[model samples]
Target: MRPKLVLFGDSITEASFSDGGWGASLAHLFARKADVILRGYSGYNTRWAVKILDKAMAGIGGDAESPAAVTVFFGANDASLPDQRCGFQHVPLEEYRENLRSIHAYFKKKWPSAAVIFIAPPPIDEEARIKYPSGQAERTNEAAGKFAKACIAVAKELSTPVIDTWSKMQEIPNWRKSTLSDGLHFTTLGNKVLFYQVVNILIDLGLSEEKLPADLPYFYEVDPNDPSKTFG
Candidate 1:
């Protein structure tokens, strides 16, 4: 069986395979290499996500031939303020950290051979969120940083690689304008940024462009006369 790449998180991850989403970009990049699994919980925080982690990983069949890579990108909802608007999704800082650690432990036990990456929560544009038609002042840049740091700590503790999207996005000029859409969601450009960031991290971890070979034979390798001859 082919190896897998799992993306576990919330809305950002659920919509990742959508148009111009980071997950979609990876799908194209890893076309035949591995099956990209999206385990996105639209409005879940780590607390809720962990409850369903077992189900999400059930198909992985932890073993030597299990998933090749996994990215646990969460924290957006965890950083939500403990107010009516986002209280349901709010996971306290300490619990969030513990949740991450628990997730790492679960994966480590399940797929020990798989390389794991953690993605810190990205920043939120408070002003933009409030202006959003269906949004409230739930997430904030400050909380994002806090959770991002917490995520980084978990990665460091687990000896895994992490992508600090929160700080990285800020480095760019007019980042608010160019990096995010709808205050909480990513813009086209931001999606590209995430795709490349993930690519770079995978490469650094010894996963190359050709690491996951095309699932099917190259077009040229197929015989035009007897297409069946090309079936692997």
Candidate 2:
């Protein structure tokens, strides 16, 4: 039987803008190799993600030996400031770290043998802050990077693997300009790039096989006025 992999995350993971966001692309890439379940929600933080995972595993009676692999991505909403536009508040770095530790402990207890991969959120476009005028975009960006580092540290403590999407994103000079049109969320190409990067990381960790397709499918475009088309 193929391994069951669960992707639990936020908007980026939820693919709020397009149909085949990175998670869908990952599912396709790992088709037949594993059963990939996309369990992501928009505007969720680590605190909520832990609850969601608890709800997901409520009735699944499998222990560590028969546990499922879980990949977690958060910190986007957690780093946001308290504003009506963003509809989320900033969580302190220490609080965020505690939440992450809780999540790590939860999965470790439920699925001791299952591999857990922590994925850090991508960098935000400082220029995009002009649209919403957060003024704290740079600070938020720094905090997000710190959150990723915290996750890596937690994973190290737990002996789990981590996929540093943040660092990988930083290496791309045009990532912000080309990947994000609004300084948040990814364009089609951006999601594709993330998909491949994630798949490669999973392969390197021996959690997944390297069977990615050469040419991945793009999201279908329709009316320009439709926000769903632009975001989902």
Highest lDDT among the candidates is held by which one? 1
Model 1: CA > 4 A from native: 131-136, 220-232
- Pairs that collide in candidate 1 are 32-215
Per-candidate TM-scores read 0.90, 0.77
Alpha carbon RMSD to native, model 1: 2.7
TM-score of 1: 0.90
Candidate 2 lDDT tens digits, 1-232: 5667777788887772366578777677666466677677887888777678768666554783344577888887787755535545566667778888888888877888777788877777766755444444532467668877877787788777777766777677687887765676777767777777777667776666554332323345445577565556
Q: Write the per-residue lDDT of candidate 1 for residues 45-147, one digit (tens) a residue.
A: 9998788888877766658666888899899999988874777889999999999998888788888888888999988888886735556677889998999
Give candidate 1's error at residue 36 in angstroms. Answer: 0.7
Which portions of model 2 show Cα errors greater than 4 Å? 16-20, 58-61, 64-68, 82-87, 132-139, 210-232
